[model samples]
Target: MLVTHERLAELGILYLEGTSVESIDRAAHAVILSGGTRLGYERLLLATGARPRIMNKTVEPKSRITTLRTYADAVAIRSTLGPQCKVLVIGGGFIGLEVAASAVTKGASVTVLEAGPRLLMRAVPALMADLIRAKHERSGVRIVTGANVKCIDVNESCSAVFLEDGRKHFANIVLVGIGAVPNVELAQAAGLATDNGIMLDETLATSDPDIFAAGDCCSFPHRLYGERIRLEAWRNAREQGAAAAANMLGAERPYIKVPWFWSDQYDETLQIAGLFREQDALIPRVLGPRGQLLFCLAADGRLVAAAGFGSLGAIAKEVRFAEGMIAQGFAPKPEALANPSISLKLLSSQHRSSL
Candidate 1:
């Protein structure tokens, strides 16, 4: 619903609906379609995105067992949720937790199985993970951490998720949201360089000069972090597409936007800006009873990242200010960051003045 064929046509774009590109002829600067149609292009951009990681080969496709990746998958999952539904979610990451919350909101009995030691162990700090876990538990969601799933046995009406330690949880619906893998097969088959994803330089150009890539399928070096990172968020994908288009038109600009991510579960919202390392110094800013912010400072005291968990109204503004500080490379004193009385907006102003 965001864009229509008419809109694209008005923009002088040729919309090829429901046609798959079979292969790329780099030397001819053309692509072969599914029906053996050859389409030539001066410049090409691959926004192939990603696919949900499957649990294992032993898990066969069933009506009751599913993975959420596309709109259709979400619709299918929603149709199966109700008061009588018993939902079991595999993985405790963002997608799993969000789906669990939605299922619980629909009066479904929900249980989450996470292989990690704690929920969100790779995404956020242990303290933040604990807070999120507590909130979910309070909302009637059963969470099992350090859970090693052996296999899923599906029957006629329900599925049983078996664990390594001789335990099984039966549910009417089983949702898998472990993670995602970039769609790099096409890029690789075309003789393009790929590592984790399609490798791109700072300008989002692929190995072939006439071709480029953006979104989840591309991995570009981040100037702020001094390393290559691929983001699967919607905002990043949208911005990267625009940037890639500009670069294709000879703009010659480097995409250096700071990374920002957010998730909504029940009445709580979690926001993170920039990348945080385990060894980074964490400064806590307590915001009364319902909100808290954690600032991650690098070894040299630079504000590298920030995370906040609470109501949207309580934490959104503060996270915005912190994001600005991180983008500006501000290094406020640890004491100033810890004290809620010292406004982050004021600190941001001071940082701008110093620059």
Candidate 2:
């Protein structure tokens, strides 16, 4: 379904569809090879995204088991499913939980099996995970925690998952909601420096000064974490994309933004404004059912990260406060952050000398 120039002219929008890069030999001064193939360009910016992780040993690469990574995957899953289907999701991370909730709303019986003890164990706090457990179960989604799957038996029509505890769950459909790995084979094959991902410095410049990489495919130095970290969130990707573009224009800018990620499952929207270090302690502050913020404090008493389940506005305020602290090189008292209504403007003006 490649929307050609003629086809695009017929419609209101300039749509280009199904035109594989193999056929389209583009020639330009600055070419961006989005789908591979050489586009003669002085500068190249690679922003290839990541793909979902699914093991063949656990699930057979058949029609029954699927990974919801792209739009095509979502369409395939939705088209082949019905209200009477029983969907067994393998992972209980953000993707797994969101898919299970969507499936349940579509009248399918969904059961989420997570190997970890709690849902979203790596992202949210323990108490927030418990709250999410209650929310999922209340919406007719059965969740099984500490579930280790041994194998997946798949026929032509369906699949039956076997657990280590000898429990078998029959499923008309199965979805693997695990994490993703960066698409850096092209860079690696080209002899570009890559460690875990395409290694880029603070300026988003790859090992090759003429080449720059961004988005999930490149691992750049994060000032907040004081190390090279890869972020897969949309905001990070967009910022990295813009940074790569700016660097290509000879702008001397470095990528030093804080990492943030947000997820929406059913009625709950979780927003995390920063990354958490391993030694950071969690400070829980519950502001009612609709608002709660978890502050991750560093050893030196500075707020490293702030995670909120239902408090989007509060998360923004905290992020602003953190950014201000970074500008002044001053750490605030951990106890002072307890007040939700604390004014960021006042904090920025009054704390100038101390910072």
Candidate 3:
């Protein structure tokens, strides 16, 4: 739905629809297709993306239990939701929370189960997570942390989720959003180097120089963080696709774009830019009653990341400025960043002027 096949064709793209690449013959620089067709490429870019992580392979029901990944899966989930429906989400991450919010909006009774001590444990700081949890709770979403799901028992009418702590919850529909696994089977079979994902250099090239990988399927080095990172965000995927194409055409430019992610649940928008750790020094900037921004600084006081939570109008521009600061490696005074009276735009401009 994002783009039509005709639009892609107009861009001089072949637009292979429903065709699967059976195997890659790296030695011959060609890929065998599902119908025994051989397609040779001067440079191959793999944007295979990722698949949703399954909670329990054995306990998976034929119906009722599902994971959201494709548009079809979303439609199926939406069809099952109603005022009388009871929805159980088995993760407290972005996808699970977002689904829970949508289900609540649809008049479904929603409950979120997080195995971790808190929601968004790996993504955001505790302060922001707490605020997000409060907002969801206020909106009638029941969130249970430290919930270790043992298994699911499915019956005709409903499913019973059993926890390791000897508690049970029942729901008409069970949605799992634990995480995702990068699709690297083809790359791995081709003897390409892969750690967390298809290993790519700054130029997005795979072990074979002619082969490149992008999006959620590849892990590239982050020059700012000095580490390898694989982002599952859509913006990261879109930007990486462009970068990979340019590199494939001999642009030879390093993919050094700042990491950015955003999620919308209910009426609130959460946006984050750059990579940050829980241990990073956080500086808070208050934006009236319903908005706040947190800046994460490294031990050396480098502006590593920023997260904003509020209405789109309240935080979007500020977060964008913070993203530029992170990208430029600007280390503004902690006091200046914490003061809401001072504009982030002004700070960024001043930093650039000083340089």
Identify the leading candidate in terms of lDDT. 3
The lDDT per prediction is 0.90, 0.75, 0.92
Pull out the clashing pairs in model 3: none
TM-score against truth, every candidate? 0.97, 0.83, 0.97
Candidate 1: residue pairs that collide:
none
Per-residue lDDT, model 2, residue 120, is 84
What local lDDT does model 1 show for residue 323? 89
Segments of candidate 1 deviating more than 4 angstroms: 62-64
lDDT per residue (tens digit) for residues 147-184 in model 1: 99998987768889999999999998889889899999
TM-score winner, 1 or 2: 1
Ranking by lDDT: 3, 1, 2
lDDT of 3 by residue, 1-355 (tens): 6889889989898877789998899999999999999999999999999999876632645465778999999898899899999999999999999999999999999999999999998778888899899999999999999999998987768899999999999998888899999999999989999988999999999999999999999999999999999999999999999999999999999999999999999989999998778567999998977788999999888899999999999899999999999999999999999998899999999999999
List model 2 lDDT by residue over 255-312, tens digit each: 8777778787776677777776668877776667676767777777766776667645
How well does candidate 3 score on lDDT at residue 83? Answer: 98
Native-referenced Cα lDDT, model 3: 0.92
- lDDT of candidate 2? 0.75
